[model samples]
Target: MWNLPYVFPMKRVMLMDIKVLIVEDDPMVAEINKKFTEAVKGFLVVGQARNGMEAMAQIPVKQPDLVILDIYMPQCDGMEVLQEIRKQDRPVDIIMITAADDTVTVSKALRQGVVAYITKPFKFERYKAVLEGYRHFKQTIMQKENLGQEEIDGLLPVRMTREERDMPKNIQAQTLQRISQYLLEQAQSFSAEEVAAGVGMSRVTSRRYLEYMAEQGLAERELYYIAVGRPIHRFRLVRQPEK
Candidate 1:
């Protein structure tokens, strides 16, 4: 009989699980999000709310570590709930889930201290990715002794780069920003021709910007058929976190 050498192992410190509160109007969507939260290893669903009022009632009781909020609700909107949360001086991290992709809406939510924004009709994998990113960010912050401004900024979601903000060779920045803003605002995808009409850009120029967005992984292309001789190609922003 052969004996194996014994080795001592280091004890790992277990971080406390994250408590989550979900505020959503749609029961089915809320359930789906709840399941996803439960599926993540270190996250726990503490409570669920169907509107802003319910959220206000339960959030203080639960004292959740995070809140997943929907913008549109009947009794009260997400902005109202957020304001209430702020008024109470709650420090819970917030992630906004909305079908409205408008730049103005997104800007408002961000200004209100939302940690992340996820558009609706997202893939499960993308949803998982965002959660994982949040988990990592949280862990990093917890483990840090001293953090600089840059280190703090690193915890947030990646935004469009300076080059991405700039227009490609011949395209104007103003034109590109307008088009990008429009796409970010809409629930559905748009063709280059449609976007051109909406933004008052030439179809050819709009196509260039769309193609650039696709190459940068900010947008994805899909085919649309409407009794078509050739299927029209449409573009939609890719909301998944960059790898």
Candidate 2:
């Protein structure tokens, strides 16, 4: 009889669980993102970062398969982080979860190589779709050396699904919308505390929303120099939403 090795085909080994590192400035948001990622199959949140600096430091340690990064952050920005990641020539993938919907930011991110881009106040369905698509693409690409045109084209759209994803229950979509609308209506730059006061909400809660808005590109946060206290972050609406 002929040798079995020549007759039987070798089975292709599939990728195991995907390790993900979440890089976001807000702890609450990071936690929420962890929960969202856990809901998806074939993914595990391996680490979390509150800022770009920490993310940069943790990448080597955690060695995550992918990163869910935020654009606006203290110490180092997301773009800079993305550039540095590319410099190492690692296969690590990046999916940006930010409020920066501007052309410049989006273009830069694409040029730097991002798997997907999700704006702030996004639904969970969108998040799931992006992750699911990324998972499929990654698994396929790694298993096959050469892909057909159709296979390549299918993976191009990191987010092809139109359905909405669920957001954390604590982060009320309604309140976030109201706060965002109020910011658009603001005549001048205001701190989170000020927005909270105007909207009759707690300062902490307002700050989280403002931070997310700033990350998304709907608002800009300016740092004011202060003599006694730390720098104050005053957020102003950068763009108006469509009617």
Best by lDDT: 2
Candidate 2: minimum summed lDDT over ten consecutive residues — where? 1-10
- Residues 92-196, candidate 2, lDDT per residue (tens digit)? 999999999999999999988898889998888899988877876676678679875434544565422312323346666678778878886767777787889
Per-residue lDDT over 1-243 for candidate 1, one digit per residue giving the tens place of the 0 to 100 score:
113133222243456899999999999999999998888879999999999999999987999999999999999999889888887789898989999899999988888888888999887787787887687667656765877543454465565555644545775567656777888788877889888988887899899989876654456676665552556778876533232
The candidate that achieves the highest TM-score relative to the unseen native structure: 1
Task: Please report, in order, the local distance difference test score of every candidate based on alpha carbons.
Answer: 0.78, 0.79
In candidate 1, residue 21 scores what lDDT? 98
